[model samples]
Target: MRAGTSPNSSSCSAWRSEAGPGVRCSCPRPRGGSANSISTTDVPVLPNAGDYTIGVSIGTPPQPLLLNLDTGSDLVWTQCQPCLSCFNQRFPLYDPSQSSTYSPLACSSKLCRALPLSACHAQCLYLYGYGDNSIAIGTLASEAFTFGSSNNVTVPNLGFGCGFLNGGLFNNESGIAGFGRGSLSLISQLGVGKFSYCFISYDDDDSKSSTLMLGSAADLNGSATAVRSTPFVLNPSQPTFYYLSLDGITVGTTRLPIPKSAFVLQRNGTGGVIIDSGTAITQLTTVAYKLVRSAFLSQVKPPVANATAEVFDLCFSLPSSPSAKVDVPKLIFHFEGADMDLPHENYMYQDSTVGLMCLAMFDSGDESSTIGNFQQQNMHVVYDLDNQKLSFAPARCDQL
Candidate 1:
């Protein structure tokens, strides 16, 4: 979910750059020690579900919640008690009154001023709308947030939203644990040097798990997995996002002729490529995406089908026989310093409704493009904020 919800439903696009968190381009370095490492409860790809969820214990007595790991947006919040318009969640709503340490932030507080659209009554209140028009309106407050199940790490005065009027892309997961480059994001608050996560491909399997490591424990040098690193480019206007430099893309071995300027970040901070965890599929600028599509259509023999699938633009019919197979071309994403050669499974997904093989990427229609989670399967991505670089290693992540 690049990931409070689906790829089509994102809060990042809805975010106004002027209202974003004041973040430094230099980045924050981590203090020593394992801040926390959470073993997530996986709810793999289901009929209409395929987003990552991590557990957190919020408030005094510790109301356990499963939150989406969203690096795309800022603000870590959960649905609180007396939810005036809450969505259906699996766990009980958090009651701030029951917690001994819960307190609402004052309207005059610095935290309240960090947001773009905020109104202060007696308490700091906010109304966040996503690009898909999803809304979460609630009061801003500080509470104790326990990080892990085993080696528990508690941050006693964490700033978060107490969502009372939440709607849109939100599903069963309580709320978003924001890891964006914003002052109010959990990553910014914890002052962690880095964070790392490896996602297994989404499937129907229920018992699978993955680990999210924060602070000093997020070191990539300690892992046996071979890795590559790419420098992180900044979007000053939209400091909440982690931007990347994409050189071009390769279909099989042939690198598509895409100008580097096509992926460049405008000085005003508008157009660029960002590797998002919340988006289910990758989205490339329309022009660049068309080139890739054209190359595939030219090489592949199967005729394109206008499949019943709603989201995907490229879907093709397979041979009638069960044993028949088609050679789906592999896609290699050329980042500034590293190349990610994804397997066939990573780029192509089967639409069970129509039995059509569909391309897992999208055409953004504008300059902004996103590298979604579908292509990141089995890749252990490390957001090394301390060094201002993104690194990855192909690993068997399901064991995490």
Candidate 2:
């Protein structure tokens, strides 16, 4: 999950106020099965909140593991034995020696070719970067990764990164487990055709408790608001990206027309309005950025200056008034034949630094409008890989 409120009790109320409404869904849970019978539940649906934990395993015995979940990247690496230097977290590092199933892919392997042995070597030797400059690096190997309660499983020769050193805000975590669409990614290797991940945040006090689901739709508890699957453009040699034809953005009853150039379509492996569970804040282009920021700031009280150089255009001071409120005009994303309407809170939050500075929920520095964990707090996001479509539904994200 994104960083929490600063270590100050004064701003506690502000944080809770900014949480908006929680999300809850009623999707069915998964049932265990064999490799051939591996249904949705057998697929790994790693969590992207709290200390950045997800499930993984090492060796033929398949010891359960929980590592950070990252979508920007496509590789699912884990810590291995003989880790000279590695960061500490809740889970134990994978000891390759103990795992009879562990095997390193040769330099000639297709996975190595796609990532380029050179890049793989760098990742193995250096640090992996995360939001807020968090970094970690580890080795790569093949192992059994189990999912669901009974642990119906799939054993693939996956790339595991054992992060030894870290800096900035990620010191509290262990290592990263990438969920991107690259050949090195766990999903690609597992042969789980298409799957979707839904994030449901716990109470503001327990942001770390937010849950993530994979493969099946068991964890999601919302009506299926399906939309046409837009073709996800794969960067050939690079990882895959989800792409959608964004016709326009709407706020309330007003539709803001942004030039196609204003938004980058299918640049990264991600396409359409790419949703990144890793980023702390949402990101939008200049045109959509200005429009959304202006509308929010106009309705709220006096404006606050941008906090960091990468801060959004508008921010609200949370502690000043009787909970400042603004009508967040629904921002609608127009796809090919369907228009998805997003709740105002999806892009509005109370600034942690400033007591009452409610701002347009996302930052402006990222290349695309990444729908981060904060925006995904109480929503069910569907990724239809086979059909090449995506869907969304409102939810109440609360602890069970």
Candidate 3:
């Protein structure tokens, strides 16, 4: 289910915007399977709207809904029955009463106090808000969570938000499955230790869905490639966010002349870099964007069209001939311990139907720099919380 809207959606502002296997998947279950073992061949994730969605079955009798998988947020919620203020959704609202496993949390429960913004009326009521002002206000409750349509795997007594009043640009996703590093997040509650996903390419029209690997399967897959790991930079004040050290960026062979301070995460938690699946495009700080914009434009071939958008600062016309190569230069991101030379399509969104090509990154002004899903297409990324590190390897996600 897609819920997040583009950052700075109202203006030129850069808008941008899992889990685990406590239980086994299709495989046989033990007290706990091997940490490196591929325990579940369970969930089927699809690219929905501009974001990604996965099938989640909640409740005892199994009520299924599509949920947005968000690494940027922490809270598993959906629009439940009795919507107080709900956005028009595509699927039927989740009816808690119909399920035998439904159980609301008490106000005094420690899980209810996990997030600072949560408040209690009679029971534990949570108020989850997004940077775009989208909010989900409802009760915090525990229910059985199942993955995949066949219901091969389930986690009983999983804590999640049952939204009664929710509104946002969800693209009709039922709600969100937050995979952030927060205690209340689905990933944390499941205690999967490690998880991984490979998003199907946006251009892949075959309509095939990808898998969300948990436990040892993700790590074993990592062992096969030219994988590189980067330590997660912690912001003590805001621990839920997965921050990384971005060393620098390069256009072709020339590194932009941006200051190192541009990417720093201050004590107040103002600016830093995060890998977000909710956002469609990459977003950079104003200081870095200006230098990168200048560098990219300086290298493009002459006769470039003056195409532009409210969010993206760079745009150009693609050659009319189908066989002609788009002359966009190679863009590279220098992370703390690795350099990712993005596929041409990853950094540049080529809307061939309109013969337009725009740089996939947005200028996020003074806000945090976001490595959105656009830059992560056809990329297999693994999050190892036990080691507190992030790893990546380029892959044909359609096949994964």
Name the top lDDT candidate: 3
TM-score of each: 0.86, 0.73, 0.88
lDDT of 1 at 321: 68
Q: Write the per-residue lDDT of candidate 3 for residues 1-400, one digit (tens) a residue.
A: 2222211111101100111222123422212222222246456667776788876667766565678888989888998887778876545677788778899999888788786687777889888899668899998999877654322566688888899999877776789999899888878887788888888887676346677877766753535447888889898877778899998999978988878888989889889898888777888999898888777788876344566532456777777888987577889889988888898889877777867777778789775798988888888899899998999988776566
Sliding window of 10 residues with minimal summed lDDT for model 1: 16-25
lDDT of model 2, residue 81? 48
Per-candidate local distance difference test: 0.73, 0.51, 0.74
> Clashing residue pairs in candidate 3, if any?
1-67, 1-68, 1-173, 2-170, 3-170, 7-15, 7-16, 18-179, 36-216
Report the number of backbone clashes for model 2. Answer: 46
Q: After best superposition, candidate 3 residue 14: deviation in angstroms?
A: 37
RMSD of 2: 8.4
Candidate 1 has a TM-score of: 0.86
Question: In angstroms, how far off is 273's CA in candidate 3?
Answer: 1.0
Q: Per-residue lDDT of 1-400 in model 1, one digit per residue for the tens? A: 2222221211121111111221111111111122333222111211115567666667665665667787888888888877888887755677788788799999998879987689989899998766558788999999877665334555678899999999988667778778899988888887778888888768735444566777766656436546888999988799889899999999966899998888999998888999877777888998899999888877767788885654788788876766777888879888988988888888888755566888888888899999888788887889999899999988767654
Clashes of each: 8, 46, 9
What is the lDDT, from 0 to 100, of the residue 388 in candidate 3? 89
**Cα-lDDT of candidate 3:** 0.74
